[model samples]
Target: MKKKSNKQVLEMLRNMAEGLGQTFAPFCEVVVHDLSNPKNAIYAIENSLSGREVGQSVTELGLARIQDPEFPAVIANYANTFPDGRKVKSTSIGVKDDSGEYVAALCLNVDLTLFQSFQAAISQFTKIDEKEVHEHIEAGGNHSDRIHARIDDFAAARATTSRSLKPADRKQLVQELKKAGLLEVRRGAEIAAAHMGVSRATVYSDAK
Candidate 1:
């Protein structure tokens, strides 16, 4: 097997960076830095969220890795900020040559501004009034409603409508309802039959 040259390795990393950029597009910036040429280190860039160009100088982190062989090869999920003050989550990877010399760096900077906004929106949307406003919406305690709910839930679990449930599924639903004591409720079989579009006799047969 042949070892890849630094240029070849960098090219492959460039391609990988492009793919990553596309996968996380509109939210991430992917960059490739050629550590061998610190003066013009930016070899390729995708999804330019940071507005950086391909011919830009190496970042401080890149330069540090280039100078220090013992520097960590991967630094992940560090907090960063864009020039425009947008919050960012970043990861940097140092690529080393066969001689164990750092030759390039692959970096990903994910913009968190939109996600932060989404978080804020969700927080506000789910906020409830502190004032006491008693409301009884769920009929979970009602025997009739519970029976109907169980049948509907069983049908949904099988990805079918209650009326479209197969014989085996209907029998399973009846067993589950019996276990829950819902089948013992007065007129429970009638209610289940109505909801499931089946005859009460059929419900009783399945329950047995």
Candidate 2:
């Protein structure tokens, strides 16, 4: 049985990426590469509203995010744009191969020609529904202790000494305190007191 060369494998990978873009696009391009020697790695820039340009490297474009440690894969919200005044969006999802090797990264850049109209029409409804859902969650829960703990966290993250009863501040505090299980879905006043290093009486008093 014959086996494939390095060139053959790269080509196969490229074809797969480009085909995926055409099949599922706002999806303008598919970028693939190994960072070890990224200069030599190939990409399949396919199904482009710009044109079907293929076979390039990140080096060729003067773009160098192949080495960023923190953001190995990111979804660029509004990073891509189109000719004749349409818009595009791109996101890259990185994954290791079956052998646990951090192989190639796949970036899917999609054009938003028809997608934008649907987005515009439904955006108002989406926002309204989300606000209503959040309101419902706020009304149903007996989470006063949990909420105050998070308020403390928000203040700490921002290095704020001043405390106010603002919803935004409360939300931020909740996110920061949430790590200590303060804003947890289930509230236990006794357990919360233990975590806060405070008296249970204080917790009950604050519940009012």
Candidate 3:
């Protein structure tokens, strides 16, 4: 077994940064900093969300790691913000040479703007009146709505749309509907079939 040189280690880290950037693309920025050259430390950058470029100076964290051999090798999930004011979650990992001197740093910055917007949307979408109202509703309409809701729920549980369910999943959904006695309701088969984008005969076959 041979120890890898600092350059070799940094190259490997650069490759890893590229792969990680691609894997979490559109939201994550990966950077590799060569600490030995603090003036132009950024050796590589992928998914450049922060508008920073290669050859940029080392970050404060990277400088800290270079200044202190005893610094933590990994500083993870720290709150950060991009130059454009996007909130970020960041992780920085220090790479040291065999002599235990910091040689490079690999960092990841994940943008949270899209996720924050999605969270806000979900909060508003799920907000409802706390007070309950007792009102007369049509039984036929209620039954039909319930049937369609069940189908939608089933598909959601499987991480798919009702019409995009695989054959086996569709069969299982039909069987569950039959067991729940939903299939016995008037026009239930027709409703389920229509919602699932299948024929009534196909729904009946799946029920069996």
Which 10 consecutive positions of candidate 3 have the poorest summed lDDT?
134-143
RMSD of each: 5.3, 13.9, 4.1
**lDDT for predicted candidate 3 compared with the true structure:** 0.92
Which lDDT value does model 2 have at 169? 49
List per-prediction Cα lDDT, in the order shown: 0.88, 0.52, 0.92
Poorly placed runs, candidate 1 (over 4 Å):
1-4, 141-174, 183-208
Cα lDDT for residue 55, candidate 1: 93
Candidate 1 clashes between residue pairs 3 or more apart in a chain or in different chains: none
- Count of steric clashes across candidates, in order: 0, 8, 0
125: Cα error in model 1, Å: 0.5
Clashes of 1: 0
> Candidates' TM-scores?
0.74, 0.38, 0.73
Best-fitting candidate, scored by lDDT: 3
Question: Which candidate should be chosen as best, given TM-score against the real structure?
Answer: 1
lDDT by residue (86-171, candidate 3, tens digit) is 99999999988878999999999999999999999999999988888865363456667888899999999989999999999999
